[model samples]
Every structure is written in structure tokens, then in C-alpha cells.
Target: MRQPVTLSSRGFARAMRADATKAETLLWQALRNRQLNGLKFKRQVPLDGYILDFVCFEAGLIIEVDGSQHADSQADVVRDRHFEEQGFHILRFWNDEVEKNPDAVCSAILQAAKGRG
Candidate 1:
């Protein structure tokens, strides 16, 4: 069974959307409005008590743009496992990777989405 989205979680997601990081903002521009192969993507979405960086429900894909703090994170491992168990494929990218090469990031995302579809 899926967990209910709590009010706090919704509020947190909203806040995250409002205070997006520089890398996130750039990626959002690339992914928003079905820009990438007409695939719809939502940012700062709340799912099963977690705030996802980007999600395409139709493709069952989740994209996470992480900072240096997420390096070797056990929490991320558990989170990725949970998402995988839920039948979602996750693609993680570093902030620098996104910032430096946005087109490459978008290409990767498109490739992943197509593979999932």
C-alpha cells in the first residue's frame, strides 16, 4: 500500500520548489513544459514521505540532482532501493555535472525515459 502524503511533506515540497538550487533551476528549465521529447516532468514532488527532485510518472522515472553531501550516502542507498521496489528507475546526477553540461544531462534523462517506456 502507498503511504499518505502528509501536510508537512506537501509543505516541504512546496518550499523546495520555491527555493530550488542553481543546478535544479537549470535542469528544470530543460525539463519543464514537456521540453525533453514531450515527456512531462514534475519537480519537488512528494512520494511515499520523500521529496523527489524530478519525476515522470508516465515513464516511471525519477531524477535526483545531488550535491557533494550525498556522496556515499547510506540514506540514498535505502531511498533508491525503496524507489526501485516501487518500480521506479532513478538517475542521479551531480550538481556540477548538471551545471556544466545540461544538454548531456537532458540527453541522459531522455535515454533513461525511453528505456523505461
Candidate 2:
């Protein structure tokens, strides 16, 4: 069974949502309200003890926007492995990649989502 989300985690998620990075805000504008191929996405979602950047639960897809700090992150590797084990496809894009070519990013995301379906 899935573990319940703790109150602190929920609050953290809320805070993350309110303080989203520039790249995250840009992507959100493109993905919100079923704007991207009509898929529903939730931002800053607390799931299984991690706060996801964006998730399409129906598609079992998680999209993460990362900065330089995430380079060679062992913790991220562990998190990715855990989510993959749970059958969720994780797509990661650098902050610049999202900012530079959101269209391409969305295209890739659409392709991934379609591939999974």
C-alpha cells in the first residue's frame, strides 16, 4: 500500500508550489489546465515522501526540472530508481533546457506520455 503523506510534507509541497523557480513557472504555464495534449498535471505534489515537480498520475509520469546542483547527485539517482521501481517514468530537463526551448520539451513530454500509453 502507498504510505500516507504527512502534514509537514504537504506544507512543504505547498511552499514549493508558491516559490517555484522561473523554469518551473514557464513549464507550468505551458502544462497547466490540460494545455499540453489534454493531459492533467499537478505541480509540487507530495508523493511517497518526495515532492515531485510535476506529475501526471494517470500517465505514471514525473517531470523534474533540475539545476546545476543536481549534477552527479547520488540522492537523485536513488530517488529515480525508487520511482522507476514503482513503474513511474521520470523525465528530467535542465533549467536552461526548459527555458530555452519549451516547445521541444513539451514535444518530448508528449512523446513520452504517448509512448507509455
Candidate 3:
């Protein structure tokens, strides 16, 4: 029998959250506990077959922190199209930027949330 979708997604999300990268951990601090404009963000959220780094449902915003490995990826273009079709705005930041300037990253997230709020 096939497992329920929610169970698999939740399990995967939990694993991803636990194994978060340094940049993900740094950014999560600012996003968690409603520190940014009282908006709640979920990490390692599974959506449409992709696991998003961070997502705020209220704002329909998805934040993706890309490492050097993501440079010029065509898969990203396809993924972006999927998100756009779903009416979610994606905000991407370099992993190094998230590590070095978390505050600025939070600020950008806040702005995006406000725009949708």
C-alpha cells in the first residue's frame, strides 16, 4: 500500500529541518518565533514535489537560499514557473549573504510579507 502523502512530506520536512545548513539555521532564527512582523515561517516545507527552504503561507512567499551549486540552473527556472503558477512569490538569496547579513535577509522577507499582507 502507498503511504499517505502528508506522512511522507512531514517526515521529509522533519529530516530536512534537522539537517539544516548553516545559512538555513541562521536565517531560521530570524524567521522563527514570529520575529519578523509577526509572520510565521515554516522551514523545509514540501510544496508541489519540492521542499522549500522557508515558506510563509500568509504571504504566499517562499524563500530559497541557494549555494554556489545552484548557479544557472535550468531546474530553477522550471521551479520558479511552478511557484509563479501557484501564485507564490519566491525570494532567493545567496547562502553566503544569509550567513553574513541575516538582518538584511530578514528585512527583505518582512517587506515581501508586508506586500502580500
Candidate 4:
């Protein structure tokens, strides 16, 4: 069953209170520039009853930084399916991948943005 898409701006504020890792912090810098393929993106954007790590509405993209707990494939697949049904393309990066190779992560996000055009 698919849940309704819902979001509240207040949710983002709460999430921001938590400590952000280097990856999330770094990615936020680039995404905030609104220069990714010329499409504006919002950091910690709220959508579909969730607060996304990053979102490019123009591209219908959601960037998620997954910690080790995300190793569970079933949950990931289910989440992806929900977003996919809403015409969103979900991009997931392991926490280490973002912390260690942020540039590459940005590149992938850029590439995904390109796909939206």
C-alpha cells in the first residue's frame, strides 16, 4: 500500500537540529547553490511525509545519505517504490561514500539532474 504524500516545513527544522555529517554538510553546500544543471535544489526538503536529505523538485530527485542501518534491502526497495510511484528518482549513497568521496557524490547528483532535463 502506498501512503499519501505529505510534508510539513516544521519537520525539516527539527531534522536540522541534529548533527549533520561531513557528507550531508558538504552536499548541502553544492545543492544550495541552485546551479546543479541550472535547477534549484533545497536541502532537507520535506515531501511525501518525509524530510529528504536533499531534493531537486525540477528533477523530481531525492538524495538520501544512508548509514550502515540502510543495509536492509527490503526497506530500501519499498521506499524507492513509493517515491517512484510519484515520479521521483531516488539516489542513495552510503555514508562513507559521501564522507570520503564527496566530489564523486556530487558528480552523481549532477548526473541525475542531467537526466531530468
TM-score of candidate 4 against the unseen true structure: 0.80
* Residue-wise C-alpha lDDT for candidate 3, range 47-109, written one tens digit per residue: 777789999888999999999989999999899898878888999999999999888888888
lDDT of 4: 0.76
Q: What TM-score would each prediction reach against the true structure?
A: 0.97, 0.97, 0.90, 0.80
lDDT of 1 by residue, 1-117 (tens): 689999999999999999999999999999999999989999999998889999999999999999999999999999999999999999999999999999999989988998676
Which pairs clash (backbone N, Cα, C closer than 3 Å) in model 2? none
Q: Any runs in candidate 2 off by more than 4 Å, and if so which?
A: none
Between which residue pairs do clashes occur in model 3?
A: none
Poorest 10 consecutive residues of model 3 by lDDT?
1-10
lDDT of each: 0.95, 0.95, 0.88, 0.76
| Candidate 1 wrongly placed segments (more than 4 Å) | none
| Candidate 1 structure lDDT | 0.95
- What are the per-residue Cα lDDT tens digits for candidate 2 across 2-66? 78999999999999999999999999999999999989999999988999999998888999999
Q: Lowest summed lDDT over 10 consecutive residues: which window, candidate 2?
A: 108-117
Cα shift from native, residue 61, model 3 (Å) = 0.4
